[model samples]
Every structure is written in structure tokens, then in C-alpha cells.
Target: MKLNKILVYVIMILVLITSCKKDIVAGEVQDTEKKIECEEVEETPKEIVIDIDDIYNSVDIDIGYVELENLNEDNVPEIDLEYYPKDGDFILKKVSDGYICVSLEEYEDENALEDYLSPMVYRFNENGKLSWKKHYDYKTHVGKIGQVLTFDDDSFIFHIDSYQDWNEGRLINDNCYLIKCNKDGEEEWTKEYSNSNRDMLANILLSDSEEILIIGEWKAKDGKEYDDIDKGLKEELNNDIVITKLDAEGNMIEQKSFGGSNDEHVDIVGYDKKLGIIIEAISFSNDGPFAVDIIDKWNNDFIACIDEKNLEIKWIYRLVGGKYTTNNRFSINNGMVYMIVTQNNRNRQHSQSLITIDDKGNASKLITQTYDQMVDKFNSLMILQNGDIVIGEGNQYISSLRIFDDTGKVKKVIHDINLVPDEIIPTDDGGFIVKSRRQIKTVPQPIYVSCIWYDTELVMMKYDSNYNIEWRKTYDRYKNNPYWDCVIPLNNGKQITEIKTDYRKSCID
Candidate 1:
């Protein structure tokens, strides 16, 4: 009986062990299946490589050329005038064939004591050659072209500040003019806009719905009439910011003005659907027209967002503590305003700061770099879609391009470049293009005379997202003859510039 009981216990223990072994094998199988499934689902993605040659070869950039020597002089009003290259702004717009440019020149009659403004428009072909040149009839009035906007059909309109009348035998620019022209350089219509005081055009912007927004300054006339023209008249005057909305047909729909007891000048403007009109300006007054209070009594640089519908000042952010501030450039991204400004300290030292202003009128300086005495005049600011900020700064002494993250941490910098960027434009392919100029040579004439000539070439550079230079092209065909100001890119991967020869200077006797 004892042997039989021992046999039964042994049999029970063997059965339990067999059941445990079967459960362990099943758990191992399930674990293996999960591991295989995870390995199949978590595959790594392939890296993308961008070919620089592909972008350059995409467009035929060397097809057409505009001969600067052969200017279209047809329909130009004849005058025995001495043309001088004026230091002004140049507006370039790309069309289907090429580009159109409008520039201003100051000319004087032999006997006249003062200089008058002449507006010149030029057209270039596909590869970028001058197709036609048009000179407006400025015999009756002195004026300068402020901005140009093109339509879908290649027709365009430009803003102009023209002399309203001969006030006491002096030509005063007291009115703003909107002149529309066809594709072939024919004037379609001319409209005049003026106020009780002198009006000057600052900029022109188009809304999303194709409406025109004309920004200018309206200054109270000093009420004193003069007999001679003053070249530096605007320096002594103060003006209020004026915004005039017009239909596509150059018809004024609404007009408004904003200012305080002192001077306010608008330098840059941007439009956003949610944020309304963004304005970068320099203000001198502490009250009136400002949505926020100004603490500093000196010249303060500010950023303001205005409601476009009713022309109300939404919010104004003044950059305090600086004695004098000057805004160079600004860009809007992700509901934030980023700009580059130069300010003066108590020791008379100049410093450049990259400032960010939020939508709620809050301002912060992201980075600041001080200059001893000479501040850089050529500066550009742009924010990429990926939250990277690109800033270009250069003087005659040095130049550089820097890329920083959203937190103002430096990512990459192309320092001590030979070219000075006149403008920096973002590309569609996550890169940027720089329109710049390089001083090729400098020739000092006879020591007895203060005659120095500089030979410069217009440079166009394309950079990749990693800040690697993809391609660079220099336009050195004009040498020391043509004086060009700006360069603009076209949709077809080309660039166009208007070359004006300053007839007033000659190194050779």
C-alpha cells in the first residue's frame, strides 16, 4: 500500500511540471511576435539630399540683356537739363517677360538755382535686358517716384510726390499722385490727392483683395513763403503719418492721419490678415495718436499694428532708453515682429540691436552689438518659415551674414564677406538669396584734387539651408560708368537692375 501511494504522488508531480513547461513556451512565442511586430513598424526614414545644380539649371538665366547705352528716348520731353544721380530708392517688379524698374533723378536747369526731380522707368527682357525706358513729363512739376505695383496683365501704378503749385514762386511738393501706366509705358490715368498741408508719399502697399494703401506724411505748412528752393527743407519740418486707401481704379475711398505734437515718419510697412497693418516708424512726440504711452521724450523708434478696417491704432510699442533710434529693416513671422535698429547711447556710441516685438505691443531686444563710431547703414532682416532668423549687416569696412535660431542662438555665420548686402530675400526652397555689391577697385586721382573713383560690381548669391554658397554671379560689365542702386530677383531665377550713369562726375580731365 505504501509503494502504490508513492507512485501516485510521483505521477501528480510530473503532470504539474509538464503543464508549467507548456505555459512558458507559449509566453516565449508571444514575446517573439511582439518583437517582430515592433521591428517592422519602426523603420527609419531616408535623408533628403538637395542638389544645388538642379535649382540653377531649372531656369535659363542668361538669355536677354538690356543695353544701358541704348536708351529709348522716344516721347521724352526735351529740356536743356543737367542730370545728376540722386540718392533715392529704386523699385523693381518682375513681369512675365522680364522686370520693370522706376528710379528718381535730380536735375537742374543751367540758370535755375535749385534741382528738380525726374522720374525714370525702365523695362528689361527675360534674361534681364533693358526693353524700354520711359521718362515722365516733369517740366511742369518736380516730383519723385515712391513705389510701383504691377498688375496681372503687366500694367502698373506708381506713387509720386509732386508739386501742388508754385507757392510764392517756389516749387513745393504738397500733393501725392497716383499714376497708372500700361505695359508699353503709356500713361493711363493720373489722380491727385492732397490735404490742407503738404503731403509726401512714403510707401505703397496692396491688400489681399487688391486694394491700394498709400502711406505718406502730412505736415502742417510753416505758413512762411519763400522765394528760393531749400534742399534740406524736410529736416526742419515735422509731419503726421497719413494713410489713404484707394480702389483699384485710383479712386480714394478713405483717408486718415495719426501723429502727436512732434514728428512721426513711417519707414516700413507689412500687412497681415489677423494683425492688420504693421508699421515701423520713428516718433518724437510722447502723446496723441499713440495707443501706448511713450516714456522717452527723445526720438524713439516704434512698431505699431493698426486696424486696417477703421484705421485705428491698435497697439504701439516704443523702444525706450535710446536717445535716438533708426530702424533698418523688419520682418513679420508667426505673429511676431523682428527688426534691426540702431541706437545712440549717452557716450555717443552707436549700437545695433535685433529686437522682437510681440502682437501685444511687448518689445524685447534679442541681440545687441555695439559699434565704435561708424554704424552700418546697409542692413537687412528676414525670418524663415522654420523660425530661423537671417540678418545681414555691412559697412564699407566689413560685412557679414548671420543665421540664428528663434531663441537668438547663433547657428551659422558667413563673416567678413567682401560683399555688402543691399537686400536679402527668402527663397521657396528653404534658402535665401542676397542682392549685394562688391568694391572691385578704388582709384585715387590726382592728390591735388579730392577726386576718388570706386569700381563696384553687383553680386547675386544663393545659399542653401546649411549656409553653404550654392552659386554666385557678379555683374561687372559697367565698370565705373553705371551707378546702380538695387537688385531684384525674378520668378524665373534671374535678376534685373537699372543702371544710371552719374553725368556729374568724371575722373579724367
Candidate 2:
């Protein structure tokens, strides 16, 4: 009887041990499954995660901000005052006085100018100080003046018209001119262009022969009188590509016009110094309207033309397929041209396109990247040394920074640059600085450019080549000022900023 009892006890003890071992094994299996799920979910886009390094203190340089008078001093936010507005175009130039001149296209007013946005010029001193400013308008046009080119130490030149036709050709008084102004915003001289019904200078840069090449458009009737656009108005629509060349002393050297009764425009132009030719690209229509929202008409093509002093085309090649929204820049290398365009799929508003132009000016789609990435409208892109392309703006995809190879492959996905890219300057060493934004919340959140969300204090940061934060500077959005000018790196670790009359520096330890 004693032996039988002892056996029963041993059996019960063995059973209990087995049960406990099974429970331990189950817990281990469950933990393994959980870890696998996390790894799979990480494949998601970076846009969903808040970067760990986005809002950190700077280490290298201290940021500075300042405000100047002669600006709108109303109920305005700090960041938005000097920040660039939507569709806000910019031109960074070095003046003879060693001052950096940054120009931003005028923005739309809530009051709509009631007509159109007028062009306002903000000037900065050599030390990145905001000096005097001015607003210009035409007697008839609905908007203000546009970008100005620094000609000499005391004066600059800009383009505008009295008839603000909103890209429509104007007649009689509809003309484009290069107006010269002194440092105090005083008018010095105005060089006008006529014969072409209407026109506006889109951009101006130095030419091969050390001349000033102005890229713009001019419109005239095929004698059809543009009856197509009557629309009950007596005026007609004259669409043409008008290019005017000027000498170093500000004299008109030549002018040329292109288009066929239909609509055409030239967005940019440059002088091929090595080839000793003036090259300009203009879009012309062979067919009528387009069915695709992203592309122009089916028959529309971009022609690369090289001309002589006689204003005649020497060689021309018509590039096909691409749409008009492509803000492409052409570079002439060793007997080849590099044409890069910022493109996206028809399904979304943002994407990337990089094309290589052969010696014959033919476009080969070298690399393309398209995904479910959402980005702000006015982003900036620069070509890297290794032939990679870097883009900056508001990224809606995974993380923040995306490095792409020439074959459309993503080399790196940076959720946080540790700094925002306010301006992306492609360095020779193959890195970039991000001028990003930061803010302080006050009021009901004021309107902002570069971002749709409103904020009071906007922080502009700098990033290194490896996406490291170099420095971050914060500025106050002012009431009257509605645009952020430009942020430049200074010699000292401390940087200088030119906000609307409020120039101050920040200490980043």
C-alpha cells in the first residue's frame, strides 16, 4: 500500500512539470511573431513617422534673424512675413557691393490686389541686412512688378507691363520693358520692346559673349487677328515666344519671335559659351488642345534652337512627348547636354524625372521615380556630384530625404535630415544644406508659404552632406511682411539673416 501511494505522487509531479514547460514555449513563439510583424510594417512610407531628429538644437553654427522697416507692419506672423509665398519664384544674385540680392515674386493678397499680385522688391545690404524696399505697379496691369537683375552697384533692372493680362497678349499699350533702378528704388532708365503685340521677360542671365540674354515671350497675329479668343472682348490672344538680347551696357542687341497663330512660350534661355551660340527652347503646338491634365497637347514640342547675331536659327531640334509643366534646365557638357525635369505620374502631383540629352539634343528617359509620395508644391532640386539628384521641399513619403540614383533607384531614405533644407545648395563635396522651418504657435495660426499650415515663428535650419543638422535659426513672422527672402551661410559659425527689419542672431549649443 505504501509503494502504490508513492508512485501516484510521482506521476502527479511529472504531469505538472510538463504543463509548465509548454507555457514557456508558447510565450517564446508569440514574441517571435510580434517581432516579425514590426519588421514588415517598417516598409511603410516615412511620411507617417515623426523624425526623431527634426526638432533638435544646432551644434555648428548659431542662427540669426532681423527685421527692417519699410515693410507691412500689421497683424502678421513671424515666419510667413519673410518666407516666400506659393508660386513664389526666387532669384539669388551677388551685387557689386558684395551684398547678396535675393528677389521673390510678389504674392497674392487676401484682398486679391482685387486685380492681381503686384511685384515688391526687398533689398539687403552686404552684411545680410534688410535695407529699403519698394512696390511697383503698372497703370493698367492688375499685378505688381517682377524679378530685378543687378546691373551695377547702384542700380538694377526688372521686367513688368502696364497691362496685366495674366499671360494674355496685350495690344496698343501692352509691352514689356527692362526698367533700370537705383539703390534707393529710383527709376534710372527704361528699355522698351514693341512690334511684338505683347511680352514679359521670364528670366535673364549672362550670355556667351558676355551679354544679357532675356528669355520671355511675345505675341502677334498670324494676321488671323486671334479671333479664337474674342470671348466678347475686343482684344485678341497673341501667343508667341519672344527673346531679346542686350549688351553689357544695357542696349538692345537683337530680338526674335516664334509661334504659329497658336500658343507658345519660352521659360528659360542661356548662352552656350563653349559652342559660341545662343540657345533657347520654346514650346510650339502642332495639334490643338490636350486631353491629359498633366501633359500639354499631343502635337506640342520643345525646340532647342541656336541662333546668330542676325536672329536666325542655325540648328534646331524638336523634343517630343514631355509635358509643359517640366521646369527643365539645360547644361552643355563635353559635347553633350544634360536636361533634367521634375516630373510625376498622372495619378499624383509630385514625382521625379531625369533625362540625358545626347549631343543631338535628344532626350532619353534615364531615370524615373514615382510613388505614393505627397510633397509641397514649390520644392527645390539640385544635381549632385556623383550624378545623383537631390530634391527638397515638403516630403509626404517615407521619412524626409530621398536620395535617388540615375536609374530611378532610391539610394537613401532619410526621415529626418536633423535639419530642414530652406535652400539646397549642391556642394562640390556632394552634400546639401536644407533650409527647413520651425515655429511657435500663437493667434489662430497665420497663413504660410512653403507650407499650407500657419505658424508664428519659422525656423530655418541647415543640414550637412550626411543629412546632419549644421545649424538652425528661428525668425518671427511679421504682420506686414508676407514673404521669407533667403538664408545664406556666413563665414563665422554664426550666420546672418535678413528678415523684415528684425536682424538678430541665435545661440545654438
Candidate 3:
């Protein structure tokens, strides 16, 4: 912009001198005013039109990567040992005066896969070119990083839970860590939090005052594979909210565990000064009818609760999932809670619940809808800037981004993506960026990223916000993608995007 102004001034001076026909413009004040007006218009910076195809022309995913379970290869639904099928990363945030994206990348090394947390962050120039890259311990247990968060312009934070190797530590060796990485993709510091039994990193809210509030699971279980799947994947039994508060420099200020031994999940948020209370929407298996069995958690749903400020029960709200409920979804915004639960009668279906729990934890069910194609079975809550909600339908195929007012009425359905929207970001302008992918048919059966955008008009019929033809970019990763994927809008009129690539391949299971 400064350069634009300078060039404009120079052009104006040149025009004035040329127009000053010494003989005719000596007294022409009108000409001087016209020149000034022209100069002002020239001083304004023009919105530079950019094209996507010119930027990220194409990508080549390294061969022999293994993350995807390989749903299709040699015509079989189940996967063999060779398919590196992993999901793309989700979550995008503003970085510095620009944007920093935290997507996933895969690298295979038999010795390296043990560390659990390996694939790291890659920095991009303002023009969206890959600048440098960083990685975590590509050694022990192959740390599964989650919830990559940007704390500020020059740095970011993410979670890492190292698994128990064949060597040392307890059965489920774990410690939740809050790491700080520099601009050049360097780990500056890290704060570790753990308990005697089982502690798994879940989510975090980096505060406005540079203080970070970390939320996760503090579960206790044995070493059996069934026990491992129950706690790690199914999120069954051993429930406790693991809360760790730390400053910007990675110093743990306060740490505690809250919740019962059944269900405790934390979706965190914070600014910079204080670590806010945990608004945990809990589901107890103890309630409901007697038709429930320990081996099958398919019949569990109860009152959701919030655990915060030590083990204090801030509030509790009842959520009825009927007799044939599979799972339920809930979220908190502006001290309010919204939930969605699935009901199975003849076939499976879902309903979105908009509820508000007061300070005492008493919940008021406001709106409930069994409307669309399929609500996201995993999660269906997105709060807009104006307090409106954009909810999804089902996990396999999120039919629409249904809008709801504060009163919880189905207002409208913005851009509809047939598959699950892995990520949706509200842009500064009255628009949004949606990033998702679908399974494709190929030898390795690649997954293609499907990107779309919707303007303020709230219509899915139209989707061109640029002067170019193709408004979205797609990528195909055949194997080994065990990380996040996102589209970053940078300040320099470019999109900073990352895809899963570069796998080193492991020798054993």
C-alpha cells in the first residue's frame, strides 16, 4: 500500500509538470484541483486479483504411505497391510498479521513411528509458498497430535500424547503437553501435565492474556487391547476432566482433574488472561433403563453436566435420547449449550437440540429438529459471530450447514456439502471457507479435498466469489495421512494450504 501511494504521487507530479503548459496553466487553479483529485484516486490501493491455479499448480504424494485403511484396493472393502489410509487434519486459525494452518503430514520410519507425535508444522511465506517445516518426536509411539491452535502471530500450540512403547513407563504411558513453536518451526518450550493412571490430551483454549487452559481426559484402565480401544477410541469408562492452565512460556500455573469414572469430555476456549471454567457436557451410563449391557454402550445416554473450578458441579442438564439412541452431540457458546442426538426406530435418524443451561446447570430445551438428510452423528454445533448457529447433519454425509437464530428455529441452510465438512471457517468478510474431502476410486483409492465458499446472500445456488472459473482447489493423497488438513487465507492475497505427503513407510504393524 505504501508503495502504491508513492508511485501515485510520482505519477501525479509528472502529470502536473507536463500539464503546466507554462504559457496556459500559469493561472489555471482548476487544473491543479483536477490533478489533486486524480492523485487521491491513484493513492488508494486496488484489490489485486489473484488466481489459485497459478499458485498451487499440483502436488505429488509420496509413495508407500500408510494411514488410510484402504477401503478399496484389489476390489475388497476391508484393507490389507499396505494401504496407508489416514484422515486429513481439520482446524484453521488466523496467524500473526497473516494466517497459519495446522494440517497433517505423514512420514514413515519403522524406528520413527514409535514416538506417536512426529509429523510437525510447515511454515509458508506471505505468498503461500512453503518456507520451512517442523516436526515433533518422530521416534517414540508416533504421537497423535490433535487440536493444533495458533496462540499468536509468530507461534502456535498443539497437543501430543506419547504411547507406551515396548520399553519403559506404565501400561498406558501418557502426559499431556502444551508446546510452543517459533516462526521458523522450532519448539521453544513445552509444559507437561500428567497423573499416575491415564492422562490423555483432548483440547485447549489459549487465553487472551497469553494464559492457556488445557482440557483432556484423565482416565484409568488396564493394558488389554479391549481396554485400550474403550478408553482411546470409544471414549468408554474412566472419565475425568484433565485441566491444565499454563502461561505463554509453557509454565503450568494450575492443574486438576474433574468429573466421574463414566463420562467427562472437555471442548475448551479461552482468550489470554484467565483460564475459564470447563463447560463439560457429560453423559452418564448409570442412568436410563435396565436394558443396557456393559459390553455394549449402544444404550447409554443421560443428563449432561458441567465440571469446572475444581470438582464443583457448576450445572447439570438432562438430555433424553429415547430408547434407541446411538450417540449425542453438545456444545457451549455464550454460556449456552446446544446438543444433537440420534434416534433409531425402524432405521436410524437424528435430531438437533438447542438448549441453554443457566448458572445453576438447569437446562431449558429450546429447539429440537429432525429435519434434514442426516445430522453429523459425531458433532453438529457451529456458532456464528452474531450468535446464530450453523449445525451439521450426520458424520458420513453432512447434508447442509443449517442456520438457526438465537431462538433456535431453522432459519436457512447455507452452502450444502453432501459429505462431512471436515472444516468450516468464517471469513472476515461476510463469507466462509469450507474444506472437506470424499473418497475417490483409484489404485490406492485417493481422497479428494472438496473446497467451497458461500457469500452473505445465504444461497447455495451460487458460489463464485472470484473472477476465475474454478473457485475451489482439490488434492489427492493415496496413503499415510494421519494429520489435519486446512485452507489458510493469508494476508498477501494467497491461500496457504497443506496436504498429507512424504511418508517414510513402516516395516511392522
Best by lDDT: 1
Candidate 3 residue lDDT tens string, 1-509:
45335534655654555555543644585578777774433345343432322221222212222222322223211111111223333344456643444534455657653434344565544444455555565333434556677755577886655555455644655564556787666778876645232244556665546666665565533212223354355454456555667777776677665444355444432221222353433444343221123423344333333333342344443333343212334455665555554444445445545665544566565666564333334344656556666665543333556667788786676443444544444444334444454432212222233312111011111112221112344433323232223234422223433333454332110
Clashes of 2: 46
Tens digit of lDDT per residue, candidate 1, span 1-509? 45335534654655566566767986897789887774445536344432323222333222112222212223211111122224444566777776677766665568766556666787866555557888875432555566789887798887775545575677565555678899998998887655233344567787766678877677632422111225467555456788888787777888777776676778778887667789877777667675335545543667789877788888977666662344345788877888776766778568877878877878887888886554464277888768899887765346788899999999998876566677777776677777766543332233233323345656677776777876765656554554443445543334444345543332110
Worst 10 residues of 3 by lDDT: 453-462
> Which candidate leads the pack in TM-score?
1
TM-score against truth, every candidate: 0.63, 0.54, 0.54
Cα shift from native, residue 72, model 2 (Å) = 31
Better of 1 and 3 by lDDT: 1
lDDT at position 423, candidate 1: 72
- How accurate locally, in lDDT, is each candidate? 0.64, 0.48, 0.45
Which residue pairs does candidate 1 place in steric collision?
65-129, 66-129, 66-130
Angstrom error at residue 386, model 1: 3.7
Using lDDT as the measure, name the better of candidate 1 and candidate 2: 1
Q: Give the per-residue lDDT digits (tens) of candidate 2, residues 165-223.
A: 44445333455556667767777777764424334466666654556776666545542
